[model samples]
Target chain A: MPYQAVPCRVLSLTGGKRDNDLILPINSSLSVTLHQDQLKTTTTAAASRDFTEDRLWLNGEEADMGHPRLQACLREVQRLAHKRRGGSAEDAGPLSLSYKIHVATENNFPTAAGLASSAAGYACLVSALARLYGRDSLALQVAPETHWPELRVLVMVVSGEKKPVGSTAGMQTSVDTSPLLKHRAEVVVPERLELMMRHIRERDFEGFGQLTMRDSNQFHATCLDTFPPIFYLNDTSRHIIALAHRFNAHHGRTKVAYTFDAGPNAVIFTLADTVAEFVEVVKRSFPPATNGDPFLRGLPVGSASLPEELLAAVVMEPVPGAIRYILHTQPGPGPQLLDDPSQHLLGADGLPRCSA
Target chain B: MPYQAVPCRVLSLTGGKRDNDLILPINSSLSVTLHQDQLKTTTTAAASRDFTEDRLWLNGEEADMGHPRLQACLREVQRLAHKRRGGSAEDAGPLSLSYKIHVATENNFPTAAGLASSAAGYACLVSALARLYGRDSLALQVAPETHWPELRVLVMVVSGEKKPVGSTAGMQTSVDTSPLLKHRAEVVVPERLELMMRHIRERDFEGFGQLTMRDSNQFHATCLDTFPPIFYLNDTSRHIIALAHRFNAHHGRTKVAYTFDAGPNAVIFTLADTVAEFVEVVKRSFPPATNGDPFLRGLPVGSASLPEELLAAVVMEPVPGAIRYILHTQPGPGPQLLDDPSQHLLGADGLPRCSA
Candidate 1:
């Protein structure tokens, strides 16, 4: 028997809120899924008569196949699919194949280290494979990619030589030891999630942006509360936060909102109309050094002033060359089916068409 | 009558814990009163009919005498002294001469910027005035300075261009907004204070050291949890913390403890024996730039190696020139009387001797 392989890329554009999911979190949390136009991980899974075990690749390089979470996800999905069909693969007579799977995923967002790049990559892999195999994804229930129309996400990648400790591990430590994290989970996050969902429902950008920034603040505060506390934002990230807030203060409204994850990189949300101005402020405040890499992508922008009004509000003195580049992108669809056979990674033989 | 202004310096060699003291804090906090041999704020005050009003000086310059906290402290102590005599200033006229007082004060620790320098300064003022006017201090009730003879406080002065927003103001914001601070004040500090007091009673240096570091971490965590987030610990303070922790882990015990006040300066505590090695670790981890200011004062610590074990434990890469200098001193005593009249800042003419 041979197994089907599906290739998938980036997923998540506008984040979804998880409110009644108490399995892991004590309260609800909202997160905007990111959609990187060019950054993706192509996952190809196939089972063959000769295949002996599951195999995995990350960034075109083989990675350990025994990761606990991956195994758990795989096991749950297969069990659910088996129940849905209500028959064993052997007895189903062409309904399915039970060969071992070999998955190859190549990532293009390697430079976005410690900022949960794998999250979007894995989301794409699961959703695409579920569609190919005619089964529901066992990991998460999410809305269609087209659900949100106006959201945009820009990732400001700050360069640092040392890799940060994985945020997943850090969060676990905080959960176990930080009293602040406990209070936030039990008391604060539930109400915040409600307010965020309300802003989302009403399409109130101001309310959404304010809630987004505050939620990010609470998350990082939990990180800081951890014993032998964890620090994700560097001086550069602090400068970016100040710049965003000061810009908003200057406008007397929320024109832009900024959030930082496990690393110093900032995810800024703004409208298409305001992106150019905000980007201009970033350039002037933390200018790229001469002979540095390209600092902006997606929409083309020109020089603009960081007006005295905005500059006066910023408390931090920006440090130049702290950021390596900025990936400019807009809100778009989640994972989608590719109609062109040329775009598929799997070949007629059920192996990868392009050699990893 | 002339008020004597005693010099005040480092305030946190011993820490106080808040337990059952719910009026302010239900818990008992142990603090080692710091006696900086050179870091002093001298204040000399004289009361005379010729002097029309109260005046004060700070660092050789005139300072406002009508600060709310100062007035409140002064009024309460004067009231307490009056009640004990059970007579008005007019009834026992010689007991209390009605005269406006003039005062002068100075500080030598400029680089020792943020850690609530004004606390020790004000503490000295209250205690000196209490002695001069024959009253008890209304601010803090504590054992005499002679209570903790073995304690020492070393203030490592880290330099920065901008001063942090005062810690007092930072804490108030945290209290009003940070849920973590509420949890700490109500649930966490009570227990932790008991442990700290026990450690103090038993003279358990290791226990005290661990608790000290943890308490500081909790305080800063609450700071981070505050809205708009207060960041007092810079890259330099972080480096110092890592140096201290890594050194302790290497020695397989807590030989030294570190705490940060509202600012970046590190208040380090260690037995007199461990100071040399700990200072060695600090110097190597954060090497002095060539021909920079004196790296350390007080005890002379020669060059030493950063052992492989200790270096392997530190997570932060050392940042150089972030610190200005280290003021080395052991825990001595609180404010003391300068017996020599020649040391007074106020001269016979009821004006500052140095003509401030």
Candidate 2:
């Protein structure tokens, strides 16, 4: 049998208003690429037909039109489309928006592994919907400006939590709050740091780990020594640091350094040469609370891909889940549209097939 | 007034007894070629004339022989010579051994800065003595080994207040004890360690210090994990390590690590990328414990010479003054005879002239 394909598009959104009426600007956007795959045996035949229909899968299950957030997002997006097309606000006649979205979302790595799978899922869903409605490219290009309120709605939906808790806004605010932020430009010797990074990329873990740990520590320490004393590193983080130091001292220099976010879970950055060594050391030293718990399993390394438009605005924190799985990434260009839209997840009538 | 040239023949005595049992087997001889300028400036006119006549310098204030270890060492050498030649156990006789030693010493840097001035001085002394004696070839051959004992003696003497508390024996024992010592024959690693040593020799301090600290840490750590536990690092050493780790964490990766021996003094090693940063951090973080105290002064860098004949036999530890300063050395040939006996520290009469 010939494999069925779907037509899908992705969009990025940014910026929003808080409940307190303070406008929180979204500095980063989320992207997702949609593709079609054979139906799994676990999925019911009706669910598979639904997938062939609306092309939407919710929470890895069949999509339901009744999901509150989905309903709210779709309504808001249609309202914005109506407004942009100079239509009357009171018209409830479907708003005449066209195109369809097929969504199949999977958290790239293990769930509950301290990776931000939730954020990615929501971001991808909203992005897919926006693309289906033909607003994705335009929305991303003008981002936070051309459609500020719509961007806010998208961000809120993607974040999925009730209170719009900062998201990328917090990162910007932190950078803005830093007195040393200005000095960061001066402290950097690009050539030297580049050489070091190259050396790191070369898998000289002894050398690379030494540098990475030092740099991260310095960066965090500077944050602490800042006027108000911001601490990204908590007790657990410090314990990890201490453990790593002891490990390096015990063994010859190995590649393992701790990077922390606003929360406690640690993101250990290590080089290929010593990654195994690091995993073993961490496994021995900081085993999970439960014997069979997979939350703190071996590190899943990968790259964090962002659109070219968003790259300059992005500032990676010691954020563990602010990032998803660590992408063992190298430099590469942004998304290139595929020639065949059939490779995406949509139906012949250019409408999403109901998966559920 | 003509600058009168003084002839001195340097001779090295090898047979030594520890607790009345022969510990050192004397097989080779050494000679030194000394000019008048090379004589100690503090030597009285009579002592100078005596040095010219006897071709030997007895222990005296001018020679800094007030140091009991230096005195004991010379006496031990003399005693062994008499015993070896006379073949009589009781005779402290008028044993005749002809050799002249020209001595010149200076302290260009601060004496208490923990520089291995003693090692340099002893090495120079040995070199000069070998030249004065007709046994230059043998002295050159065993120069590295010969310096080890004298260097040990100098450490003991200068450090004073001791019964050879920290002896070179512990350090040199590795030569006999290390199982990997024989593997040097089959190794093809381009002697990365040697390249590191060469980097040290070129006074590439940043490179040297980094390697030195790492090697020293490894060396001492190995010692601690040796069959019987040995503690080369003390509390101060731990403090230094903690601080370096902390500092490195704050900055980007700096090539600096700290290593210590039995003493409290620390040797900090850093590379070019991090040398300046390390120095600044050290200066800011570690002010002198006392106003005028010389120890714990900022890092003072030095190099090792490639000893001519026995590079393979000698392993230089990076912890400066760990066993006192290592001779900046490369491998060279063994000792040889000098053409001019007049330039020898020992005159033709073969008697002590100058007080050593």
DockQ of each: 0.55, 0.01
lDDT of 1 by residue, A1-356 (tens): 11222212111111121222221444554555555464455556655666787776655556787986677656655666666677555535233446667666655665347556656555656665565456654433244435556566677888674545665566567766777676777677777767777776677889888877777766777776676667777767767876787788879899988777667778888876777778877877777878746788755655666667666665356678887777776555445565666666656565565663
Give all candidates' CA lDDT scores: 0.64, 0.34
Q: Candidate 1: fnat, from 0 to 1?
A: 0.52
Over B28-110, each residue of candidate 1 has an lDDT whose tens digit, in order, gives 34566555564666666566678888788776667788976677666665676677667555535333535666767656666
What are the TM values for chain B, all candidates? Answer: 0.85, 0.42
Off by over 4 Å in 2: A1-169, A185-193, A222-229, A271-277, A291-356, B1-356
Clashes of each: 26, 89
Candidate 2 reaches a DockQ of: 0.01
Candidate 1: list runs displaced more than 4 Å: A1-23, A87-98, A138-151, A301-306, A312-316, A346-356, B1-30, B87-98, B138-152, B302-317
Interface RMSD for model 1 amounts to 1.6
